[model samples]
Structure formats: structure tokens, C-alpha cells
Target chain A: MSAERQERIEARIAQLNAEMQKREDYQAIIRLQRAYGFYIDKGYWREASDLFTEDATYEQGVDGVFIGRERIHQVIVKLSGGNPGPGLPFGQLYERFQLQPVITVSDDGQSAFGRWHELAMLGQYGEHAEWGEGVYENRYRKEGGVWKISALHYFPNFVAPYEGGWAVLKPVEGDWRSPELADFPPDAPPTVNYKPFPDQFTVPFHYPHPVTGKAVA
Target chain B: MSEHLLDALEAHLDSIELRIARQASHEAIERLQRSYCYFIDKGLWTAASDLFADDATGEWGQSGVYRGKERIRSYLALRGPEGLGQGELNTHITCQAIITVADDNMSAKARWRSDNMHCTDGTGSWSEGTYENIYVNDGGVWKIASMHYYVTLICDYDKGWIAGDIPMDPPSETLPPDAPPTEVYESLPGAYLPAYHYPNPVTGEQPKKPDLPELPESGEDTLADAVAALSTRVERLEDQRACEKLQRSYGFYVDKAMWNDVSDLFVDDSTLEIGGRGVFLGKKRVLEYMGIGLGPTGPQREQVINHQQFQGIVTVAEDGKTARGRWRAFVIGGSSWAPVNWGDCLYENHYKKVDGVWVMDKLHAPFTMYTLYTDGWHKATTPNTRPESFPPPPDLAPTVVYLTYPNYYCEPFHYPNPVTGKEAPPPNPAAGGVANMADFASEES
Candidate 1:
């Protein structure tokens, strides 16, 4: 073999190794945040989408089953009620986060499987009851030279009773619920009655909201 | 390429693969007990030794060290009649192991739990502690070359709690009286028992066994529950790691002055034979060795013996009534003059599943070499006598128990409880208390 050809092959191997390492690191960070319910409450749609791939699969309801990144986007659309970003205050979302024990990385360092736990209150589920409290077992993959979440499986550790009605709401007058107050229209003064998806809109995985009895997207 | 060079390359690659296999084996060993502590507590040594390398090394106490498969076999022969035969004392547990696999897979570090505590009597005295370990892949098989344990705590039975020795205290104060007599917690050795032997079915009338408690039936099946159940199995595996920890605790006392408890860790008729030393039989004789080795004159005098680091490779039987375990013990014993090395000796032990619980059936401290200094005079033989006399002068004790007890997670089987007509739970934890929030908080704190 020619010396130049050998050198080129070596360089490609080095590049691929570096890429794999970087992807692994990136995926670990995303997993850490996702398991803690950080993105769910913050409602970071695009960023959350970036964490996963265009064809990523997801499931975070009573059923513990979901597939396809597009479906995840649709679920988020319902979460945001057509809003572009996560609506909850950053403090409220990131407040309760705890990493799980035994985070396992693959031998080749290209993939990882891990679990994490979190605790939080979900007004979206019902009348301001603590909802986000559970562990998540996740699988990640390297895609297009970047690590993206390939699958996220979620379930609550324990469910607590809630009081307030659960339905995505647009903050109205005197409500300190949402930090993005400027985004609301003056004429339709953000009302709790605003339905994100049309009433007839039927989304899959209809886990009943802890409070409102409405399907959780 | 020269054949020699090829051989060297192949050896290196083999070493790497072996290391990885060792790491996985170590992880499995660590989880053996917790996954089947119930089996271990019942004294199943034959099943327990399956976790060990064929040519495992170990020792009984500090006095004898055995090497090679032949010696291990000899040691096992001596385990019976040593009070570790079957259905003797209940094994205790406390474990935590950290395993790291090398990229090449030739060697690995298994930072394991050493907590092996036991209860000879059905009360609260617990002889507990920790161990240390180093696992190497020897010819594609992970074998423990060195293991040791540091004994932290040893609690003997309190005679006052017996039905007659002293009146049972009534629940009075929220916090009990402060500063009770030190004598209450003082270490006094010797068998304290009512001799509640199991029904021999020949001579004496056996006590009627109580009705077996019903287990919660498997609930409705759901995918989520199935996944949760998977985690539960993993949790069980994690708990199995505690078996080595429990052995370590037992080692501490055995290394020190509690030979009976160490013997109790095995089946009643167990035998032990370390190289150089002749064989010892029954729990009583094993205790005699403990009394001498860990006695005042042993070289490790003034040094507390306990399991500070430990690991186990255990396999459960298909019937769930038998198993065998091979483990390593890293001792942390010795005083200023002779401090115990943190990493030492690999203990090859055997276990059994009598009834439903796990217990040590045979223990072989096959290959233990010591590195410690101390004050007492080194004596080839002592006046303290054979097997029963432990706590020998610091100078008399060997540096390590070359072949330790109950090889990796080998499980054993036992006769069914006539009353329940099923396996019985091993004795309760020596540290009496329900496993609950309070215990968790105390452990965390």
C-alpha cells in the first residue's frame, strides 16, 4: 500500500473516533436534562426537537409507549397549545432534578443506556398538583455525526391526586403562570379556556390528565 | 511475522479479552448474593463455589493459606463437621462493589463490599464489616489473586435479653437511657445457646412449624409493570453483590477473634484445609482457629480484622434451592507496627440454599499471603489448643487467610421444612430491625 494512502486512512479513522466521542458526550448531556423533566416544563420545543432526531421515537404517558419523532412533535404542539417555546418558568421546570443510579455507556463509546429521576408539580395535568415524579430509561444513538436521542421511555414513579382542571392554558390578566406575558394578544386576553388543539382533534396515547380528565395529547 | 511476535500479539489480545470477561464476571459475582441472599442464608456451599476459578486460592483464618484446585478441594473436604455443614447460623449482608473493566480486558479492579455479618443466635448481636479486592483474568478466566477485609464492628450476644437472664425492658422512653454500662456492649466470646436443634426426626419431638406466610401474588400484567419488573431483577442483581460484603464481615470476626461466627457462616459439617496446615472440621474447630489467630498474640494483634473490600461470583440452582459462590476478600487489619495491606487474598468459598435462604456450606482460603508487622512472638504452635482457640497472640496469626470461605455465589440445597413443607427464610439480620425508611436513613446518614 502507498504511504500517502495509509496516512489518509489513518486520518479518517482519527476523525471518526473523535466524532464518536463527541456524539457520546453530547447525548449524555441531553439524556441528563431530558430525564429530569427540564424540557417538558420549560417547553423548549425547537431545542428539545434538536435533542432528538427528525425520526426519533418517544413515549411519556400512562401507556409508556410512543414512536416516531413527528408524533413527539405533535405531542409537544399540544403541550405548547401552538406556542413555539416551553411556557413554564425556568425555575419551576429545572427546580426538581435528580440523576438515577447506573448510567451505562456502551463498550465502543458510541451509545448509552441510563435512567434518571425527577420531581415536579404539573398544573398542565390538573389543579396545580405535583405531577412530574418518576424515572426514565433512555436509549441514545449517533446520527449524522452527532448523538441524538433515539428513544425516551418515561413513566411516573408515583401519582398524586390533583385539584385544578388540567388543560393547556394561555395566561390571562392577574395570572403569573407564564413568563412570556408579552406574547399574549390584547383582544383574546390569554384565557384558561383556550384549547391548544381543536376540541375534535384526536391525538394518540390518550392518558387522562391528572386533573382535567382531558386526554394528555 | 516471526511466530514469537505473533504469539506475543495474540497473548496481548487474549489478555485484553480476558480482562473484559473478568470485569463482567466480577460484576456477576458482586451481584450473586443479593440476587439470592435467601439461598445463601440457608448454607448451600456446593452451589456457592461454582463462582470461583477452578484453581482458586484461599485460607481459613490468618494461619493457613491454600493454593491450587487440589488444595481447594482438600479445604472443602474439611469444611463439613466444622459447623458449616447445613442449616446452622444465618448469614448476614452488607455490600457495595465498584468494578472497572480495562479496554484490553486482561485486568480489572473490583472495589467490593466487605460486610459479612452473622447471627448464631436468634437475637441482635451482629459481627459485621468490609473487604478489598483485585481480580485478574488468568488465561481467559477472571480469578481472584488477592483479597482482604478490615473488621469494623463485632457484637456478641447479650445474655440479658434471654427469657431468663434478664427481664425484657418495656417500651418507656422515646430515646432509651443514655450511657448504659459498657459491659452491655463488651465482647465476650463462646457459644450462648438453648440448643434449639432442628427436629432430627429420630429421637426428640420436633416443634410444630408455623403456617407459612402468603406471598403477594403477581399482580395484573402490563407492559409498564413488565418493564418495572425488569428493573426489579436488576435490583436483585445489585443486591447479590452484598453476599461478598457479608462474607467480608464474617472474615473480619474470623480474622480477629470470632471463629464461631466465621464457622457459623458455613454449614455445620463443613471442613477447611489451608496448605501447610492440616484440616479442621466443624464450626467448633474453625472457631478454635479464630480464637488463636485473632487472639492477642497473633501478628495482626491490635489490628481490627474485617472485610473492607469484597467481590463474589455466584450461580443459583435451577430449583432455586441450591447455589455456589466464589469471592475475594480485601483485608484492612493490623496496627502501626503491622498495618494490613488494603488489597489482599482471594477467598474461595461455597454456599448452600437450605430451605429458601443462602448460607456458607464450605469455605476455602486457598491462596493468601500476608504483608503485615506486629508485636507478639511468632509461635509454630500455641498452648491455646487446636481449632477452638482464636484470638491468639498477634505474632502467631499468619499474614492472611490464603483460601477464604464460600467461593463465589455457589448455592446449596436443604431438606424442606416439615412444618411448612417448603424452604424456610434464613435467620433474620443480626442487626435486628425491619428494612424500612429508618434503616435507610441510618445507612444514608
Candidate 2:
């Protein structure tokens, strides 16, 4: 190719990268973070799966090596459907994540990651409550002109039990009133609230695998 | 973050990657705790020695001295199983274990039971203790670096009281002398007696079905099941630790001035070392030391006693059975000339799992420095306890005894000092041996 043409090509590439940083894309990244926390808190496994790219990496739990969308789904499944609250019984939980400090864009303008110090808790559906406290190390990438979660990590600082046992989730502090939760019989036992106390933090998916950036087929 | 800065940061991180590899796991914590306890419980000196940093300064309770890891290891070998057989084995049952990871998860504070135990066999044997530990997670493994084992209760059953039943052996030097006519009894009287029999309650005989409490059966779960079960265990441990009710209980022991509860913090045949005060052999001696030193009759002489500046650090080993800690205490002793300045030495502790529960086996108080009205106190605080120039005390000397409270009156005497009434020149404490507060005072004065 001619030198002039080469310069033009490079210029075009830069322009395209800049175009990827549209306001919508930034908002989408924020939504991705919110969706990840929301789905997990509300037990919306399927929706949470869609927030990530088909082949995106998801690291969950203290060990951190837990990887892959399938593995991520597995952890979500274990968390949502397994012992303790197991989701459905808890109703549609209203989950809120307060992102703090500031979320930054990538220098290359192609990828961005947010180190969010999150204070998250859960309660019965329609109840404004919390379960415990933790923080998130989240990553986002612009793929096919859209921002999607490339990697998501969660770290817990403390795991204190809620009043309603290990299943019924409760926040540390907040006025959580759930009038809609009256569907359960007045004599219904409170759901067990389960919390995981993490000591070891491992990189998700300890199994050796190439870091593939291409979307999953 | 700039690429250059990020790359530099990553490189720095890589250099210290070796530390990351040694980061302690929950299991490693449990193992270290178990190893230390086993070292004390079964007297597995070799295994116990391997659990600490090679260059560690260990206090095997007050009984084991601290110099280097090698010295501690040798000491363990020298004080083998013979030291273990005395106390009826009791397990440490931890309901909550709180760990804070440092140096990439190599160190932590593991706090659990503030409760103590009394012998069911009426032998009056008990092991009540507390711990604050600083650990190093080495290569994904947890090893104790420094541990403070505070024996809140260290009482033993009178062997003479249960001679025929329970096949009681005469109290070894390693065990506490709970018999009558001993000097310790002269100071703290009526503190020991048989609690309950291990065998049938009526016969007062060693129960064939030993009355040892049964541990809750872990649900049928394989190692793979640990993925879930371990998570639950970790969570439960954390919650138990966070509960204010539990932490408040720990404050109770120190606040209530229950030093005899030291034995309950450790397993049977556990050792405790007081850097200044002479080493106390077993749980029995531990109780004696506390009763005579920190207890009501000790320097802590006061009717409305108050011990301020109490802080503790607990390190729960990955193995679960063993944990270590350091508890700092600022004591106020109202003497005539000047108030006594005492800092309870850091305790090096080892917990073991006997029948699946954690119990302390060896505890050591290695570093204690007191500021007295006398000038000798400054030199007394040095790490070294044995001084070269000081001659050894005679094999046995009359023990120090004094009355308690308002009628308190006792004579001040120097240890290793000839009773002939002549004080020797100060010695170089650098040469480690075994010296007491008297030696420290004489050298400083």
C-alpha cells in the first residue's frame, strides 16, 4: 500500500475507536455492572448470562478461579437455587448497587474496567433490605460496537448473618419494608439467609486456557 | 492507569510473587493449628517444629524458650511425649474463626472460644486460655510466626485426690502440683479439686464410655463436597467471629481478672512461657504462675482491679485445630514508691484437634517488659532472658510466698543471688540461658 494510504488507514482506525466511546456505550457499561449485581441479587440467572459476551470470562467466589459463562452460571445456580434462600422463595428481589469513586474509560479507548467498591445486601422480594457486604472488580469491553462485561470479580469484606436465619436475606442497615411479601402465610417460617465468608481470593478459572478476545461462536 | 506505570507495578508484583504462592489456605490454617496442637498434645516434636518459620522466635507456652526456630524445635524434641501424658486430653471446639489476610493471605487473626473447661474426672484438671496470633502464609500455606497464648485457667486435679481411680500417676514436674502443702497452695488456696468422673457419675470411676463430649457429625460429604461444605464452614466461622456476643466474652476473661482460666485455652500437656517470670511447665504450673503473678494475689494487687489497654490478635491456622494470638495488657499496680509498669508478653500458642475440636497444647509468653521504680527495669526488657555473667541459682530454693491484699507484706529477694546476702555484678543478658525477674533486677541495679 502507498505511504499516504497507510496513514489514512491508521487515521480511520483511530476515528473508529473514538466513535466507540459514544455516550450510549458508557451508559451501557454502567448498565452492565448494574445488571450483574441486580441479576445475582434478584436471582435472574438467564438475564445475568446475557450481560456478558458469549465467550466472556466470569470469575466468582473467593477462590476467583471459577470461570466461563457456564461455570459462572453454575456459581449463580448454586447461589440462587441451592441451599438457603434458593431465589424463587425470596420473590423478585429489588437489588441496588452504589458505584463509587469514579468509573474510568480505557486509555486505548477500546476497553474499560471499573474497580467498584460496592456495598450490596439482599432481602425478601419487595423488601428494602441487605444481606452482607462486598466489593466488585469489574471489566468491560466494546465488542461489535457494544459494551459487554468481559470479566467480573466479587470480593467480600464481611459476612454477618441476618435476623431471618441463613435464607431470608437482610441488609445491615436500611428501612426495608416489603408489603408485597405478605403472599406467604403469616405463619410462614422466615427463609434461611446464607452468607459465604471468603479468606482466599483466586483468579477466576485456575484451569489454564488462552485469553481469547474473539466472541464465542 | 498508564501502560508504563501498570507494567512497572506488575513487575514489582512479580518480584514478590513468591509470597503470593505461599498464601495460606483455609485448610492450611487448619493444618497449622492442628500441627501445633499435636506437638503439644501428642508431643510430636518434629512435626510441631516444622509448623513454624525456620527463623521463628517461638514461645511454647511459658515452658518452651524462644531463640530461633531451631532452638524451639530442639526444645520440642527434648520435651517430647513424656510432657504430654499428664492432662486428660480435651479438644478445642471453635464455633467461629475470624481471619484477616495479610502479605497475600499469609497472616491473620483467628479468634474463637473464650470459654474454659474443667475436668470431668474430678481430677480438677483444666485448660483455659486465649490467643492472639500473627501468621505468615507461606507458599499458600499458613505458618505461625508469633503467637501469644494467655492461660486464663491452668488448674490440675490433685493426683493424690484421685490416686486409685483414673489410674492417676503422681504429678510430674511437667504437670501442676495440685497437692496440699506446696507453696503454690499457700498462695492461692482451694483453687483445685476433682470436678466429675470420666466413667459413671455414681461410681466416680473412670467411665468406660468416657464422658468426653461428642462432636457434631459432619454430614456425609466427600472432598468434592467441600466446595459447598467448605464455603459454609468458612461463612459460619466468619459470622461466629463477627458476633459481638462472642468477642465480648473474650473481654470478660481479662476484665473479670480470671487468669486461672488459662488452661482452658490449650490442650493437655500444653506449655506456657513468661519471658520475665520463669517458665511454667504444664497447665498446672500455668495456673500457679497466673494465680501467684497476675491473679488476685499477684502484682495485680487491688480490690477494685482495672486492667486497661487490652488488645488481642488471633490467627486461625488453615488446619483449624491450631491458632495463635498476642494479647497486650497494661496493668496498674499501686505500690508505695511508684506504680508498676507491666506489659504482658506476647503469647506464642499452639492449638491441636483432639477428636475434631481445637485445643491449645503449647503456649509461651516470650516478651514481657516491666518498668519499675527500680532502675533495673530498663535492662530487664531485653529479648534475652539468660545472662552469661550471672551464675545459676542452686538446684532448688525456697519459693516466694506472700499474703494477699491489705495485709500484704513480703520480702524482696534476688534470684540466682546467693542467700548469703551478697549481690553479684550485672551479667550480659545477650548470652541466652534462663534468668528471672530477680536476675534482671540485679543486673540493672
Give the best candidate by TM-score.
1
Q: Per-candidate TM vs. native?
A: 0.28, 0.26
Q: Which stretches of candidate 1 lie over 4 Å from their true place?
A: A1-217, B1-246, B274-278, B296-301, B335-343, B373-445
lDDT of 1 by residue, B1-445 (tens): 2344333333433332343343355543343323222223334333333334465554322213445544443444343432232113333343444454444556555443323323332332334433344455666545554333333344433311111121222212432222232212112121111111121111224223223222223477532233234333332332343344345445444444445555666555665543224455665666665565445422232345544323344444544444555444444343434432322344456555554345556565533223221111111111212323333222223323322111111111132221123332322121112232222222211
Which tens-of-lDDT digit does each residue in B50-150 have in candidate 2?
66766565542344335456666665555444333332232222222334444345466553322222223223332334455556755544577754444
* TM-scores of chain A across candidates: 0.52, 0.56
DockQ of each: 0.01, 0.01
lDDT of 1: 0.37
State residue B401's C-alpha deviation in candidate 1, in Å. 14
